[model samples]
Target: MNHKLLPLKVFLLLALLSLSQMFCGINIQTENPTADPGFMATGIAATLTARAVSITPTVTTEQATQTATQQPTETESQQPVQTEPVIPEAASISVSLDTNCREGPSGDYQKLGYLLPGQTAALIGRNSTSTWWYIENPKKPGQYCWVWGEYATLHGDISAVPLTTPPPPPIPIAG
Candidate 1:
């Protein structure tokens, strides 16, 4: 064919091949234009090698002796991976309305502070009637007091709350 048109056809073929990334050999440029075609493809010819190789590999078949290969006594073993135990969260309580936190479960006890509508406290203990909840004081940090559960929202494991005995009633004093 025409040598002048060959370069343009090759370039168009390369462009089409490059647009479709599937063809791997499109961009490969031969380094030695003077190298022999047959040996150059094998990479050894790229060196313009003369009298490059004379060695040839030959194979022979033979029966192996029983002692030639030994079987392993033990195999690679994997130990069990240890995981951390998941602990359940403690129960909590929230007041629906502003409620009074008292020293004891009853109304007679001295009022400590008020647990507001939006505040939450830990439901530490519960009375036998379940009417009162012992909680971390919402107003006073690091301290605890009892609040009536009538307007309270109980969350988490409520059964996990331990039973507690409330203090005795306050004695009335004459003024």
Candidate 2:
């Protein structure tokens, strides 16, 4: 018998014995060969168990795999890569903080949306003083809203952004 198979055979025998040990145990005794071996009564003896198993030896530290490095062979490479400079898109407002985007150019206007931090909105129009930009509503598509310039940073040209007149407030202002 192979030495490697010896452990497997012992493991199988122990497994079968452990199953029988669940119900009863076996006692080996010497007697007449023909005599009837009477009922060998047994009981579940213990709660905890111990068994020997075969496993690879543990090392104190991780072992690194060794590999042979190959020397690079000479080969011809490709042409110089062509690149284009990225230009910032014109007429946009990026809000530094979460600010209310309203129906028109003032605080009196009903808030239609929010210009959140890291959100950029297209600038199509501005107030006469450029203090408010009439922008595409960040929350509603194709609808327009106005955001205060105080919390917004303008990108590209505002010169060509058309001057927008403020619309009448949706609610009557309290005097």
Candidate with maximal lDDT:
1
Candidate 2 per-residue lDDT over residues 1-175, each given as its tens digit: 6875575466556645875684364443434334222311111111111111113343545776453333333334434454455443478887655899998988888899998866788898999999999888989989999999997777666788999888876777589
Q: Which stretches in model 1 have alpha-carbon errors above 4 Å?
A: 1-69
Predictions in order: lDDT: 0.72, 0.70
What lDDT score goes with residue 53 in model 1? 25
Error of 2 at 91 (Å): 0.8
Q: What TM-score does prediction 2 earn?
A: 0.47
What is the per-residue lDDT of model 1 for residues 133-169, given as tens digits with 9 covering 90 to 100?
9988878888889999998877667988999988888
Error of 2 at 90 (Å): 1.9
